[model samples]
Target: MSSNFTNTYTIHMLCANKYEDILTQFSSPIEIEDLWLAALTEWCHSPTAQCNLGTNVPPNSRIACTDPWYSKLRWITLGYHYQWSERVYNESKVGEFPSLLYGTTVNIINFLKHLIEGREISSNNSSRLLEQCQNYTPEASIVNYYRTKTTMGFHSDDAEVDKEAPLVSISFGPTALFLLETSEAIKHEFDAPLHGSFDHVLPIYLHHGDVVIMAGKSRLARHAVPLIFFDDDTEVVSKGALRVSHNVCDKIVKEDHNEGVCIHCQECLTYIRTTRINMNIRQVMPVHR
Candidate 1:
């Protein structure tokens, strides 16, 4: 749960602790933990309902498209479904998401904004990136689950129409090595080592309950999660692992668990007891009718 950054784009890392902090704080319904649990429960059950490239894929299409972990976490659209072109459609072709998911989306959006207020966002596009986030309301969320083997290629999240808004990312489970490219040049350095030239790239170790907000110039900058270290493999596993195994990790973790501390539970501990989950929430402007 270490955080580092230069004066370029502002990357705020919230909750520099393990997943146990997330489970404890978010377990209470009064603290909006129920919203996160509800969203996770709905997606795990509705395996085929995750968002895709939105071609001719039907509402019940099982095609995972580009994302292999789509079954664990799907795109839950509140107002519209996002297309491959980065635009959104008002039609509920992919069907609407649950109320709990929508509520959780809003909560994350506001939390991100609040966490990075007044922070300078290095952006040549416009100077008001942080200003825009002040009033931003996210309508779409890309929920993702990851195993030790899963690796995300370098990419920027510029699909939303409102590019001014920041991206809110929440991490759970094992620690991960996250990469951020500072240069405007788009380089797919997925194979590069964790540490790149300090001038161009910054490396971060993201742990469970760590919240990252990429706003302003950093919002559009290229980033990726190149490596994930699961708890089972690491010498020291987060205390949250015990909570997840015991079925006391709130509603979502319990629902995903089986009888006792079963290792087969995908939510509890799959992929040799090393599973990670991330929620990337963004704002998609609705097309004016």
Candidate 2:
């Protein structure tokens, strides 16, 4: 933990002249991705259903996602009942998580507290969030597994009773395109691409071990993932496309030259080529509050 490098990076300033600072690339010595994958397989057994958002899909569509199923993970949010809901219906108590998962959750929470105290978050909403984060004890998590073709629409996480707490997102496997936009972008009709001149969208390339803390005003900021780089367009140059890298964390291939993907992470990257895993840990305060 002491050897980690955490800092604030501003994507861009909004029209209100307020700069949104996101905590990105907060590194840690522990193999976070490995822990995430292990917990994913151990906890989330039995294939679940895909997100049925009432979108039309042709019966003969060849896309793998046309017949999609559940690829996301959760902490104590088991059972087929609350699949799409934000927080676990009956939130697990503290220390109820597996040894590895609990440790990781606490480590992240502490890191966030330190980050907020050390830096100055610009938005008033975030400043208030920092106060909640200090005393925040997370009860559940929603971990989503995604293939290259998987894409989630623009939306905000506002279900928790304690809306001030930020959403902590960790990425594992190949990089993907993450989009963040202003509240103005939340319209009745969602166009895949931003239309007109006023569409305020910022595209971010989230890579393995990359941690994004969406707190403060950024928490309410509408965001989504439109595309993922599952193929070798970015990795292969002279040679033809390479097979997916090994999935295990420690195992590394000798010939991966991607700029961001590191050798230590290649084991998981190569194996989980067309897919990614995301763990979003959050605190859901008591209902009475």
Candidate 3:
């Protein structure tokens, strides 16, 4: 990551209670449109949400959905909100985790369990896997939005209270160059006290719909998104939109009740052409603790 390039982003936090109080804090207070409020409340019992749209902008300025602020949104946090500056999850800021995301993550973990047990996932014997996933609860998520020239610096996800649980990451939109490195490799590159191997670094190309699991010994491995390949191809974007448009439309429809007010798939196609979205989910609390 370039030290000179400032990381611009916004955070949408799910707050189950005090929805009205939180909204009042915004300089130019905005309501959580009815549809979104309903969806959030239904999925996580969060009646309100909080959004921090960077420090550079005027706090009292009313931000429209089509404003430049939306494009600058880099990340959103759900469930237990993470304090980036402090590198810790605020226990008091917790909210109910989204069920849909949790279910999807559980399914992914089940597949991983089958691989570990030396069983074919297609064998349809998921009873054992389902039982194992019962222990994994997704308490937090970081949704990263990457635009052109956006990059994530090398870092380890050690803020969670439980480091043993697997970390799941889902990718969408354009492809990105993901770099995974060992702790020793990071030390060597930074010229830290211990001499480490540079060979431990691995570069991976992640395309849309790809899932990455960091578990076992690699749970806290250092990783980074060094680059994103934004393909301006219309066909590619259209296909990509088709893959996620239903979910997007569903959410939008729930947020607005207007009979004809709906975001078309074509709008999603246009958005896909310029960005990549990554959903990084993790269990922030220890099950045994």
Best by lDDT: 3
Say which prediction, candidate 2 or candidate 3, comes out ahead on lDDT.
3
Q: Write model 3 residue lDDT over 1-289, tens digit each, in one string.
A: 2111112111111011100101111111011122122222232223322334533332322222234765776766778988878999988988666676777677667656655466433223335333434588888987787877889999999999987677888665677888777543332335434434445665566654456667655668787998888873434334435434433444455534333335563354355456677878999987876
* Cα TM-score of candidate 2: 0.60
Tens digits of lDDT, candidate 2, 1-289: 0112322222222222243434443334234544544533444332321123322322321112213332322132322223354533433322243456556656666766665577644444445656756766555565566654677888777666566665667665556688777544434244676566336666667755566666666766777877776653332211111222223223344464433345544433443545566766666674346
Quality of model 3 by C-alpha lDDT: 0.55
Model 3 segments more than 4 A misplaced: 1-65, 119-134, 183-198, 232-237, 242-268
Q: Tell me how many clashing residue pairs each candidate has.
A: 0, 7, 3
The local lDDT score (0 to 100) that residue 71 gets in candidate 3 is 70
List CA RMSD, all candidates: 8.7, 9.4, 13.4
Between prediction 1 and prediction 3, the one with superior TM-score is: 3
Model 3 is weakest, by summed lDDT over 10 consecutive residues, at: 14-23
Per-residue accuracy of model 1 over 186-282 as CA lDDT, tens digit each: 3444775443354466667775555676666566877788888764343223333443444323333455344444433334434324556677776
Full-model lDDT, candidate 1: 0.50
What RMSD does model 3 have? Answer: 13.4
Task: Name the candidate, 1 or 2, with the larger TM-score value.
Answer: 1
